[model samples]
Target: MRLSQPRVHPLTNDLTPEQAEVLAPLGQGGVIPAGPVLNIFRTLAHAPQALKAFLTWGNYILSKKNDLPAREREIVILRTGFLCRSGYEWTQHVEIGLRCGLTPDEIQMLKAGPDAGWSPADAALVRATDELHADQFISNETWTQLLTHFSQKQAMDVVFTAGQYTQVSMILNTFGVQLDPGQTLDPDLRVG
Candidate 1:
């Protein structure tokens, strides 16, 4: 939401044959299909090696390797996306969040932040995200609360997930990555 329009347009003629070949594997699977590439992927394709490296880390975070459950991970991701006001991140994750078992109401509550009437466990998750966003470190109180519901690995995953999404939000915002075709921006995420 920081920029009115994309600073870097998606790849059209700029991609070399080698770059195109490198990005070809990304089209095979993941968030997008193998056809008309999404603007995000296309723009990222500009740096084929960096894009490939990013996908490796991204795959881990989105995969089972991160100790947080899918639903819990979505909670962190959605909250992080909201705090950063990254429309692209929020819109894409909204669907993924729902698929991971976050109710529409719970997704809405993420906009309100940690005190949006969530249960203790969920509230704790939001509180950790908020703390990390505001202070760049989770407070001891929030850490304790997180301990009640998550294992040490899961707790660490919370930090990693929040951190990863925070970085992603920055990329989406600063790069002005727009929502893909047929996708609408979340009302709260709209920039002036």
Candidate 2:
């Protein structure tokens, strides 16, 4: 974790009318959603307009609209989250990754990166993510490898997914977002 406490605390249950209006769309019957609202959403509610815009892009990335399949997208997301050391992003995505068909071993391999005994196709995705993280551009070799298993649109989505999660990791880290209740931080996700 980057900070001892949240830089921006979660929203209180009592909200002003304007604040309620801003957050209404995220909930049902004009009431805040039940259960523990994610700290990310709660913190972001402070800037309702920006949060609204963010949800649009976030939905696209998480939705079937992205050319990558759910599992493949999760690969990019989990790897990006690991590389960026965003515990919040990683923990949240772990559950999503499982639902997307990533096994426990596969999830563990993500921490070992592109060379962690993955199939060529899966490895290529992780390699591309690493290249983008390290150089902000994929090398010709990785591009060629990616072309073997992905359509041009799917290949582009690999980059987009990684980029999106990288940005998300930055937000979660910089904002000092904490894990929600019952969500434990991964032992490996240590900040320097």
Candidate 3:
């Protein structure tokens, strides 16, 4: 939504030798198995080394080792994408968020922000994500609220997840990564 069209287009050809090697770890039998590679992967393939590094870190954020529940992680990611106004990121993650346990109504509520009647635990996460997006740091009060329900590690992962998606939203928005086939942007996220 940031750019009307792709500033950098996704790779449409077979991978170069290096692209295949660097991206192979992202494929089956590596750090994270790949299905059909998405446009984001193809676009990022322009910088294979960086994309490899990204996959490693991003895998940690999405993996079980992150300590935050999958649902909680999705909440932070959705909030980050929504706040960053990245329609591509929002649409991609909406399906993932649903699978991770957020309902349609709850996903809509994310756009309304932290005070949209979340449970105390969920609200703490929303507020922290909001602070991180707005201030690049969560306040002490929000940190305290987060600790009331989340372990110190979970709190860290909350920040980690939010931060990752903030960067991802930037990439998706800046690159004009359009929705994949059959995907539609949320009505509320429509930009003129």
Expressed as tens digits, the lDDT of each residue in 16-59 for candidate 2 is 67656666655342112355557888788888777878878887
Query: Residue 152 CA error for candidate 1 (Å)?
Result: 0.5
Cα lDDT tens digits for candidate 1, 82-176: 99988999888998888789999999999998899999999999999999999999999999999999998999999999999999998888888
Candidate 3 weakest lDDT stretch, 10 residues: 25-34
Instruction: Report the lDDT of model 2 for residue 37.
Output: 58
Residue pairs in collision within model 3:
none
Using lDDT, rank the candidates from best to worst. 3, 1, 2
Give the alpha carbon lDDT tens digit for every residue of 74-130 in model 3: 999999999999999898888888988999999999999999999999999999999
Q: What's the CA error at residue 19 for candidate 3, in Å? A: 1.1
Per-candidate clashes come to 0, 0, 0
User: Mind sharing the TM-score for model 2?
Assistant: 0.91
On the 0 to 100 scale, the lDDT of residue 138 in model 3 is 92
Alpha-carbon shift of residue 16 in model 2 (angstroms): 4.0
Can you give the TM-score per candidate against the true fold?
Answer: 0.93, 0.91, 0.93
For model 1, give the 10-residue run with minimal summed lDDT: 26-35
Better of 1 and 3 by lDDT: 3
lDDT of 3: 0.87
